[model samples]
Target chain A: MSAKGVLVRVSTYAALIVMALATLFPLLWVTSIAFMRAPERFAGTPPLWPDHPTLVNMVNIVHQQRIGYYFLNSLIVAAATTPLSVLVAGLAGYALAQAKFRAHRLVSWIVMFAVLVPNQALVLPLFEMFSAVHLINHYAALILPAAANAVSIVLIQAYARGIPADVLDAARIDGASEWRTFFSVVVPLMAPMLAAVAVLTFVVSWNDFMWPMIAMQKVDMQTLPVALASIDREHYQNIGLMAAGATVAILPMMFVFLASQRYYLRAVSAGSLTD
Target chain B: MARLELQRVSKLLANRQVVLQDIDCTVNDGELISVVGPSGCGKSTLLRCVAGLDKITSGDIRIGGQRVNDLPPQQRNVAMVFQNHALYPHMTVYQNLAFGLRVRRVARAIVDARVRRTAVRLGLEALLGRYPRELSGGQRQRTALGRAMLREPGVFLLDEPLSSLDIPLRAEMRRELSALHTALGTTMVYVTHDQSEALSLGQRVVVLADGQIQQIDTPDGIYKEPSNRFVAGFVGWPPMNFLDGDWLENSGLDAHCIDYGIRPERLLLQPSSSADAFIAGRLERIESFGGEWQVEISRNGSRVIARVAPNPELRRDNELRLWFRREDLYAFDRATGRRLQG
Candidate 1:
């Protein structure tokens, strides 16, 4: 290889490393502090790594605040939301992309417009509708509204368009019913996008703070993030304890993302249909 | 296996656009019929209607002497080969070939036997484990054909199935398709915009334009006697030359009531002076297409093109005179565009 080419390659790796560190530093620091002794956390010119590691903060947070229960609540919400939303969005996206209808363009426009609407703006209406249905403080309050996600639909619709109408039509002519075609043909072909959307839905549902806080007013019904904030109000001075709580809270999503990382990459560089 | 018939079949989109209107045609049992038209002449739509992929706005379609308008595509027992060869990317060749019967819950042993038998017939046995992405274009095309062939439907609908292949591959597939048609003896409808493809492959050609069928005849009949002006203009290489019928006015004929066309091959450059008539114009340009040269001539703002033997003496901007017998020109009604019988 030429000297110039080697230099370009070296510099590209350098830039990527810098960006990677920038992205990972916050999460790494929180994890590091979670294992640090309390005195080291308050020490002057705080060290990046824990000088003497310990699990006191983890035990304290779990024992004192019932973090496990709140974590379970968050998991339940995510578990319900991800599969339901993916299925709904998958069907809707497939229809919007392939099915011909009188209002096809109109329905497509509505989906695009819905993506632009802020989630904060819908809280009031969503709350009122849920309240009317007597679902406040219920897990359904979180799972129901999210099941019909617009952004996921748009993501899926963009991917689904790449699935040629010929494939769908061929299936129909081959004796597959509409629903069977979707499951046997479209679903398998769209696996990468569905996996990516599943991860995104899980992360968003697990980490959501604003609506869950307002809806789950009962202390025991509160999700992890809401319960963590309540703990944060009184224990603002305990940085190690807060770090421990944050670290535990971040673990589930980390695992979810890591498990789905390969499919996520495929979704990003989507040439699944060709391969 | 079955005769297919369309009686006054019409398709109108929800946007109130008429895609096809009053299309009346039929395919005898075990016939290979081609529907030829321009790109938007609704030829694909016509094929789709027969396959039940698209519903007709009105009229009855019969297969095997049974009304099939209300039957779904699967229940209708019709198979289609799309222009793009729509093999499932996620499925292997074996799965693709077996999909039709598998969906209907056919016996597993029978499905395997049929898929294996077809793979051998199409020379695709070794590639049965491979996905579509791993196959070459011709291999993919064969897989698509195999998928449809395995269905063994009463009627086969092919929408320009070879349109995506290269020239050599297209000709090769065309020959294979004819042999397969003959062997199966199944009624087949092939839709294509390529007129020559229609003529060469079809036992009968159905010409269409402006959302309606123009003419349906044998290849020889269509080329020899086009039913109207559109068929004449659309179904020929280098096209027929249309001249203003008024050019015959000086010959004691009332030309304003008719339009006229002459095939380029019929015009003689150095004719006997005793010919019935002549068209004189300036040779605007000459294009050599290997075996022959097509020369365009303009006369009083009207253009006339003629295909002639490659002549070394033809030059641009020169005066060119071509003579034709009066009987050689095909005449059409001026307003309705219908052929005016001699």
Candidate 2:
């Protein structure tokens, strides 16, 4: 209502809009290049929007480079990983948060330790185990290692602490078995955290590069990121083709985030579930 | 309906703390028994042991004449209504009421019938679809009671179920609990730290202090004849006033041999000089509520609190005389806290 307040509000929003544009500029540029004409991509200073847009790069990547196949491979890995990771992480987290079995503190310390151990550092031992088991090229190599995620477990365990022990005891007094109580009471109570863990697993599995690159060495079995890198070498000169492929690769992550964003938002405001 | 029994039921924490010690009690079939204690007195722990929610370090608990020490909560055939209601936050009232029957694998038609009937009985029919978070505290508590009602277990264990409610709602729930107990006539073990709740609602009351049972008696018996000094002080509101045995100049009781306690309400504010015992002290404080007043009288470094009718003429710091019948005085051993017979 005041002149100073109005100016401050206007300038704040203007600054936010500029920052948002800065963050989105690269994705926007790649999307524009994906539709640009071949000659437009080669222009000395490329235009923000292509004057002559075409789907030639998209067609080439799908038909010749088999980007669709690689996309499918990525989808399979992520789809398998999300629910598996959610289940394993949720159960372990709830136990760490509430259950009173022996060595609970020790196990919690171990999980915290695991969270500090970087995923990249485990590549050698993981590769060795997969090699010994003779399943290095299989989808199991991607899904299994990620299913028991320490960070997700920690997130879930912290959230699960909000669940009062009385509700669990009520379930027990009601003749519900431990498994029945978990599915009927605990799972719905932990919905937001589980949803959050699910989206994180999906996005990470979809965009993973180093492990997928080493594990899926076979050309036909490679996931989107590894396959995209392989194509990048041959199509380094063709910006249009590379952008088209990158655009396709970004779709599923966006889709997964959008699909589960409601519960993901709830997770940010968690721990008000119990009295 | 079932008879509940505790046979020297003792609980020891992992740190070697004695929580409950050699507690023995019994509740006849179809009776409502209340356990009352101060916080950390193991009243809730005793209920949990009966519910099989906590394991006793030693001793046996029985329901329906069957030893349930080793039984899981589900197999013990008991229902518990927790202090905070403990209704599943995510479940609607209907689902919460139906949970017990559903988990016991009762047929869907029966579960629905029982849940709806119980909801209607508790006047929760219209709010069946609302989750616990959407309901008021009273509504949540009723839903919890309904859930336990649906179980139709051999015994019901309630752990301070009305403690979270405000004063008026607590009175309402206390009455409702009594009505429910009368209607079902199932063995109910209600635990609360409120002496009035224990006295008003229970057919019998068990008073606990410092992880031990001080007394188990009818409400009137617990009030009229406390077994020890702890029960005498803990059970009554405004607590019993203690007078040093040595301080009373003409008393026949041996000095330092017995501790004397008298209920606040038992003290009279009359100026009578004929009674066997009486106290005179400067009026120190006055507190009034619900048409009754409690005043503190002090003299010669001694204080006596007495609950009496409102006296508009009384002024602070004025020397006041209070009297009690000699028979009203209670004596306990100074060291052991055990009752001393006249």
Candidate 3:
């Protein structure tokens, strides 16, 4: 509409594009390094693209580092965590959203506060509890503790609150029980948010290193991030092998985010806009 | 279908402000009752309380002569259509309509038959496969109605069911609902703040203000003989004009009359005369409404409106005398706002 407006619009787009590249450059650089030979990867002047590309690092990680076992372990932990987290969060969210119970507001406030508490604070207590229960080097030590997430509960509660009370009334009037209403009406209506929350929780659980490292003393029980860190430590000068291990750890989450970006965006926007 | 009653009902918020106070009313089996009020008057809260959605702070509600105050919504056999339609966004119209029945473990064949019949009845048959977001406002409303209808509850609770539609669609749905009530012979309690909707759709209208029932009567009786100034002022568009004046002590003036009230359309223009029901005023403005002109008149620092047939004789700044039959006047107690029963 005006010269100044056009100039501002163009600069805004250019700035966003530049910022996006700046954020994504590290991941791209790691992926490029994963494809290079050790000579090119360890060279003083790192090449943007490998002149003599090789699959040796990926090959070595699979055979020597046993990345396959770690991959399976990560998948098991994430698979165990995501659905359990969604289920527990969904029930808690629905109760918070629809049920009229004493101390409801106080409980919701506590959950919101729980979201702010650092996971590191819980690590020591959880470690102590797991050790007392003799769950060290066991997958249950990792899987069971992640069954509930404060962030997912908050997201679901905010989403479920948007559902009109009358819909529940209609369901109840038709002789549907509270449990049935949750399954039939609330669950279906909150599907998009559930998908987004599941993916986010899965990514968090899969990439988690501190808790898994402390719990799983055995090498076979170690998840991808712990396994990747071990590989980096063992092969300190092998940049290509480290890059390959990092790429494996990062690929699944990238795919998950790409596939459900719409739901993730909508869920995030809905959470921010609600009172 | 069953008779319903709200007896000595009251609702106080946690801060102890009464949102609904000492409400009492009853509907006969298969009768439609409309509750009308301004915003924040607890009409929706009252409807929710009746539908078992809101807890009543005190008092009992009865359906079919049985107390339902302690019962949950499912046990109460009441269906509610919400103001915003509240259709499930992910479900098809067919799924939405059948959800309730399926939840009840109704036979699949029966559920299918009822949904089909309701869709046909509400003209939603073709739209059954479409989701809520795919339909227009009117279609969504019809789907909501269809969902409630399929439940076949003892009582129907509609909360401003047509408020979201366009003006023309609202009129169409109003007629449709009135006709459906007659056909189904179901006890319906509809809530709306729109006077016309309350008047046209209700067999009896309950006017609410500040959580209290002001009047309960048939639409005609309430309009013709409002029980108080609040009801008189609250009902009817181009609301009844109020004039502040002392009762005349002359021979023709009645001793019991306090203030005079007249409907806008009933106030006739007349030349200056010694008529018992006459007011002298200056015409200030005229609004033409196709068939009739609404004239605003000022008299002795008081304003009044009169609906008159379009006329070249009426002009702004002209002195005018407004007259009507003596029987058309209402007398009310200025201190208490209660109408002095004629």
Query: TM-score of chain A for each candidate?
Result: 0.97, 0.95, 0.93
DockQ of each: 0.67, 0.81, 0.52
Report the Cα lDDT for candidate 1. Answer: 0.91
Tens digits of lDDT, candidate 2, A1-275: 99999999999999999999998999999988999997888987668998988999999999999898999999999999999999999999999999999899999999999999987899999999999999899999998999999999999999999899999999999999999989999999999999999999898889899999989988878999998888889877888888999999988878878998999999987758784
Error of 1 at B234 (Å): 1.8
Give lDDT tens digits, candidate 2, residues B303-333.
8899999999989989887888888889899
The CAPRI category of model 3 is medium
Once model 3 is optimally superposed onto the true structure by TM-score, how far is the C-alpha of residue B223 displaced, in angstroms? Answer: 1.8
Error of 3 at B60 (Å): 1.8
The order of the candidates by lDDT, greatest first, is 1, 2, 3
Report the C-alpha displacement of residue B199, candidate 1, in angstroms. 0.5
Candidates in order, TM-scores: namely 0.90, 0.97, 0.90
Question: Least accurate stretch of 10 residues (summed lDDT) in model 2 chain B?
Answer: B245-254
Residues A108-216, candidate 1, lDDT per residue (tens digit)? 9999999999999999999999999999999999999899999999999999998988898999999999999999999998999999999999999998999999899
TM-score (chain B only), all candidates: 0.95, 0.96, 0.95
